[model samples]
Target: MTDFNRDALGPPAGLVATMRLLLVEDNARLAALVSDGLEQQGFAIDRYESIDGAEHAQTIAQYDLLLVDLGLPDGDGLDLIRAMRRRGNSTPILVLTARGGLDDRVAGLDAGADDYLVKPFQIPELAARCRALLRRPGNALDSVLTAGNIVLVTAERTIRVNGQAIEATPREVALLELLLRRSGHVVAKPALENALYSMEAEVTPNALEAIVSRLRKRLAAAASNVQIKTVHGVGYALFAPPAADE
Candidate 1:
């Protein structure tokens, strides 16, 4: 039996918007375990048993990070990684495999994987490794985000308005992080939905609206100069309200 190290990973602090991941593992049992564990740690996971499914998914959606197993049914995971690099895709990839040989690790890295983790490892360590990769410069998930009077520190899961700390629910923090990162531009509704919830989550039609409403109230009560404007049938945009003098 594989030890998941769930206790060590602990509960994810819902600090930033959920990071989406593509997991390519042919072992059904192991795939389920990894996906569930990561989801508990605030990551949205899309699992595929083969390279073909994963390739198809990439065509429609973007993933923050990829967890791939070397032994796939259709092809080698390294091939997929190499293809992604060849096409100029810099999305971070972490190789997860049972092959622990030194040469194997070197090959994985040479093929463009940012990190490699041998199987039968602790889930906490895997989660930490994923965070390390995402922290690398130019990744979609940043450590800190700011807009107008709002400042959010993703690492610490803290948000403040004009230096005064403000409390926010996990969902509120997730929504606020996405909005703050793309401040002044309308973030499409589907994109926001993907960031806020996992594929397996049962989200109501009004789920996003509820989160937006709550975050709006929090900012208002904190006297934030920033505002979240609904585009109605489009999406939401966060921007600083124009100065009174203007």
Candidate 2:
């Protein structure tokens, strides 16, 4: 197991909103504990006690991360990693097992695991490793979203424009994030409403409209090169402003 001196911080709210993880471990107690810890950090986790179970689950759901134990009840976890890589699944995988030998670590990496953690590891350490993997370049999950001169740091829930940081209300931040995620594509008004407020929450009819309007003005005032385009009854899209010539 790897140890760290400092405690690990939980993932940011915006990053956690979309992350889904698959944890394949046979020990029910450990699985439950790890699942709870990750959930508190804003992750959605699915647990599987055997290699066969995880294999089946992967066919139906997309996961942002995978935590696999080498000593599975049915088969070696490396086989699952190999299979996923063979099928072009690039989701980051972290091996969580009792295998502490140097060769074991090398084998795990060679078998397509992004990082390896031995048994008895701290939950915070595990979570930190997971975060590092997701932030890796070329991975489907990124810690930041960028459009022109505007950058949204998903982990910190902060926005920057032209190298300057800007403060935004929670609602405004949520609205901008939803549009930024679907940049260059239309995000329907209904979807925007859902993103801003929960289904059970009582939302005023014009609540979403108000949030969008405020965010639009803030972005413009900040001189952000990105703009949010309203699609009338449809929705909105975030994108770079058109060239002056166009």
Best by TM-score: 1
Q: Which runs in model 2 stand beyond 4 Å of their true positions?
A: 1-16, 136-246
Q: TM-score of the candidate numbered 2?
A: 0.51
Q: Model 2 Cα RMSD, Å?
A: 14.8
Which runs of model 1 end up more than 4 angstroms from their true locations? 1-13, 136-246
**lDDT tens per residue, model 1, 1-246:** 122223334446734456788888989899988989887766778888888888887897788999999999899999999999999999999999999997999999999999999989988688778987777433334677766777898878899999999999877788888887677779999998997776355678889998899888988999998889999999999987654622
Lowest-sum lDDT 10-residue window in model 1? 1-10
* lDDT of each residue in 28-124, candidate 2, tens digit only: 8888888888876666778888888888878877788999999988899999899889998899999999999979999999999999999898886
Clash counts for all predictions: 0, 0
In model 1, the clashing pairs are none
Q: Rate the local accuracy (lDDT) of all candidates.
A: 0.83, 0.80
TM-scores, one per candidate: 0.52, 0.51
| Per-model RMSD to reference | 15.8, 14.8
